[model samples]
Structures are given as C-alpha cells and as structure tokens.
Target: MGAAFRARTPSLAQLFDEDMLGDDLEAWLNESFLLKRTFRTCAVIAGLIDQRHPGKEKTGRQVTVSADLIYDVLRMHEPDHILLEATRHDAATGLLDIGRLGSMLKRIKGHITHRRLDRISPLAVPVMLEIGRESVHGEAHDFLLTEAADELIIEAMGIGHTAGE
Candidate 1:
C-alpha cells in the first residue's frame, strides 16, 4: 500500500485568523443583509484563505448561474463606480442605500421619453421637457439627481426624512 496521507480542513476562524483583522471582518459580514450575508461571508473567507495559502489552489463549488450572467447583472445594477464606492462606505455606517437609489434612478432615466409620454398624456409633456432641460445643466442635474436618490432611499427604507431636523 502507498503511504497514507491525511487531508485536513481548517475552521473558518482559523482560515480567517485574528492576525488578519478577522474580528473587524466578522463584524462587517454580520452587518450585511440576509440576502447578501452568506455570499459576502464566503467571499471574505475565500479571499483570506487565498492570501494566507498562496501555494494552494482554492476552488469553489459549482454555481448554477454562469459568470457571464452574474457580470451582466452587476453591469446593469452597478453602473457608476462613484455610486458603488459611496454605497460601500455607507454600509459600514448604515447611512443609506445609495446603490438601490442609483439603480432606480438609472431605470427611471432610461424610461423618460417625450414620444412615449405623448401617446399616454399630452399634459405631461411640459414636465418631461422641464426634466430634459434640467438634465442638460451639469450642476443643476447633479443636485437634482442627488435629491431624488435621497428621497428614493428614504421612501424605500421607510425612514424619516431630514433626521436632524
């Protein structure tokens, strides 16, 4: 018989050790919503394992969805790097859901059209025209977009607006 070899699996805490800021990482993972918590936790743990054991190849379980499909979804939902960065920072502080707001705004902006609305209601034409005009002015458009995003976030979260006030 050939020489016997033992295969050992490391515990999660061992894979993501304390020396590598495991406590802070765990806290961050725990703070995420239920929908994202498992995937984020696995990603963090896999990343840590890869960092610690660069020589060993780490393979994940087969996923039903293809990588291309996942990339397409990300491309659709996460269009702006600035918005993504803001969302990541806000996650730690529990400030706001900027990602969702940005996604909603993107979809709404895409659907805004004079021809489409003209068929539905002629009275709404002036409002669409005003929106089109505001969108052309850089600074005004940015301010309006931010306000709309904030309002969308607040309404979705069912939170009070103007918390300090």
Candidate 2:
C-alpha cells in the first residue's frame, strides 16, 4: 500500500508577502496553511505597524499619518474585517484619497501587529507611495507626484539648498 502523506502548508505572512496577493483577505486565508510559529510572526508584524500609525489623512501624494497608534490597533484584530472595509476601484487612481489610504494603512499595520512584531519607525513618505502603488496609477499617480513635488519646494525653501552646480 502507498504510504499516507500530508501536504506542506504555507504561512499567513508568506502569503501576504507574496507580490501577487491583492489584499488582507487573501493573506488571512493564507494563514490557515501556516504552522503556528509563522502565524505568530505574521500577527506580530501587523500589530507593530498598526501601533505606529493611528490617524491617517490624505495630504497630496503622501497621506499625513501617525505610526504609533496604528501598530497597537492592528495587534488586536483579524484581516477579514479590515479588508472588508476597503473599497475596490480601478487599480489606477483608486487609493488616492487620503482617507481611504489612511484606512488601508491602518489595516496593513493592524495585520502586522496581530502577529506581534515591532513597529517600523522613521516612516518615510516613499513607503506610503510604495504600499499604495498597487491600487493607484494614471491621473492619481500624477496627482500624488505633483503633491510631492510641491512639498519638496516648500521643504527645500526651509532648508536652503541652492543650485550652484
């Protein structure tokens, strides 16, 4: 007789980390396949991100965000509930709204926190664009880019880096 066999399973973190996975719902399902330890890791990361960013607002190309609170909230919940809250639109220009972007960030952070990982700090503006890129493009991208450009102008003025090259 053939020997009995069990299929190897994947973890929630791995699934979410996969480039193709669309959102949190997909990641949660991925968790079912993971070993206990992996699941814990996933949850920790989600929690940390959540604790770090709390209130999120759309502010041109990048959303005005608070990292600490977001990390804490994520540690307490599952992804299913969070993804359900995100509205799907054209991948291009879909997540441009700061309100929506903030919510999504919260969800992502929440996912990390639940897994019990430390929150990432020194939150860079580029990080926000990268995270939301999958859902934004075209005019939306332009809008964000323009906003970033304007901010650079204001920031540059404050620092005074003259062009003399």
Candidate 3:
C-alpha cells in the first residue's frame, strides 16, 4: 500500500509548495491592484497563516511565515512601498504584526468596492479574468508583470497622441 501510494502521488511538501505558491500569487495580485501597498503583503501573509492556523491572533497561538518565501514574492513583484531591509528576520519572530493585519484587512475590504469600480478598465476585464485564473492555477507571474507594463505604455502613448492633436 505504501509503495502504491508513493508511486501515484506527489510528496506532501510538493503539495504544500504548490498551495503556498498559489496563495502567494493571489496575495501579490491583491497587493498590486486592490491594496496598492507593500505592507499589504504582510496583511496577505497573515491572512494565509490565519486560514491555516485559526484563532492565532486572539488565542496567542504563534503564526509565522517563511521569510524566504516572502522575500521571493516581493523581489518578483517589486512593490513600490517595501523596503529592502524589511524582509530580513531574526530566528524567532513572525514577519507580520498581527494587530495591524486586522486593520489592514478591514481597510482593504471597505475600499474594494469603490476602488474596483473606479480602477478596473472595462476593456481589460476579460484579460484580467484570464490573468486571475493564470495567477491562481498557472505559473504566469511574468505574464502579469508584462501585461501591466504594456498597459501603462499604451496609456502613456495614448496620452501623448492626444496631446499632439
């Protein structure tokens, strides 16, 4: 039975890595578009920790994130607000402040509806949906970054064209 199970499935660490990557990508997108803040990464990490190990904040249960994973995501995304030194951690501490996380979540939720309506481009919605799916289930981190850069270029060009006319 053990041999058969081993032959048919991925190891637990592999599965956990995939899950963590997915969550990290989701959190990246949420930080990029919705929250537009680097500190929101901490909020996202805290939320994931809470989901995995509930009641930590209230019960004083220790919730922690792998600093390496956080650094990798931040390096890739290059959020405007994160400082280089912030990712470093001592051997014994969690990266996020649990007390601040709840308030960040509340602020994000409160602003989302209005922000979504104001910010999302109608033409980009379909592509955004595809990007969302790719972000969640596929390795499309570069794709998302490229799309955002291209969009900014196109918008800038449009502005230049309008100004010339």
Candidate 4:
C-alpha cells in the first residue's frame, strides 16, 4: 500500500480507499503464511494433522512443526504431491470462485485500464511487506538475512535499499 510507504517510513494507516478487486487478487494474497495456513488446514483435512485433540496439550515444538515441516519435506522430496501443490495452489489461485476465476485473469490481460503504478499501490502493501517478514519460512530465512546483511555492508559503503526498502 502506498500509505505504508507514503513518507518512506511506515506510519499507521488512517484512511481507506476501497480498491476494485480482480484477477490480480491472487498476486496480493499469496504469501507463506497463507500457504502455511492452507497446509495446516489441508493437513487436517488429509488427516496428517490433528490440530484439535482433546486433552492433548500442544507443545512449543508441535506448535512450530504443526504442518510446515511435513509440508516442507513433502515439497522437497515430492513436489508433485497433492498436498504440496494444494499448499501453494489453493492459496495462490483459490481466492475467488473457481468457475469464473480463469476468465477474470484473461480479462485482466487485455483490459482497457491495464497500467502499472509509478509507486507501490495501497493494495500491494501486504504482499510486499510479507516478502521481508517471512524469514522463518523455508530457505528464505538464510537467504533474506544473508542478503540483508550483505546490503548492510553495501549500504555502509554507499549502495541501494534492502529488500525494497
């Protein structure tokens, strides 16, 4: 959201400009948290997870590994696995009704109002912010932290922003 970047420093947003929703909805909502949530949901559905078990106190380790570890292992070794695909595909492409979703994307491609914003738009703030805040997900933790530290050194030597800062 441009409001998040209005002054180059994050200020709590106060105004609301309800934007039109379209096929690009997928782009905004697809993030690791949503995927992880979907995996946990699907894991429960697939009977791979038992999120609610009576008298079963959840441990910290269990909290950390609920569905993510299984999902990650499956993703690495069995990328074609249904649950793995569901983790990504469900959240990324299932935001709206399945029947009409495909047509909306095609319409977006050649729509009369198609254009790119010069600055980050308000609707894009969540997904963009999510990119940095996902250090705990997959290999992103190592890669993002290393990249940020490298940028810190580069910034010390006069360089560019870190992770789209």
Query: Each candidate: what lDDT?
Result: 0.43, 0.40, 0.47, 0.61
Candidate 4 per-residue lDDT over residues 1-165, each given as its tens digit: 445455535332222111224444444433346666777888998878778778978776664455778866876789788987776667656633444555554454533332458988899797788675544355767888999899779776564444446
Q: Lowest summed lDDT over 10 consecutive residues: which window, candidate 3? A: 84-93
Q: What TM-scores do the predictions have?
A: 0.17, 0.16, 0.25, 0.39
| Count of residue pairs whose backbone atoms collide, per candidate | 0, 34, 0, 2
For model 2, residues 1-165, the per-residue Cα lDDT tens digits are 011111213434443343433465344433322222233334345552222245754446553343323323443564343322221112113423334554655567427432222554455456755664334233767888999899989888767755533
At residue 49, give the lDDT of candidate 4.
Answer: 76
Estimate the lDDT of model 1: 0.43
Off by over 4 Å in 4: 1-31, 53-56, 59-64, 96-165
lDDT of 3 by residue, 90-118 (tens): 10133234334445554454243212245
TM-score, model 1 to reference: 0.17
Q: Is candidate 1 or candidate 3 better by TM-score?
A: 3
Model 2 accuracy (lDDT, Cα): 0.40
- Writing each residue's lDDT as its tens digit, candidate 1 over 105-124 gives 55555353223222636675
lDDT of predicted model 3: 0.47
**What is every candidate's alpha-carbon RMSD to the true fold?**
27.6, 21.1, 19.5, 11.8
Clashing pairs in 4: 1-122, 1-125
Clashing pairs in 3: none
- Clashes (candidate 4): 2
Scanning candidate 2 in windows of ten residues, the lowest lDDT window is: 1-10
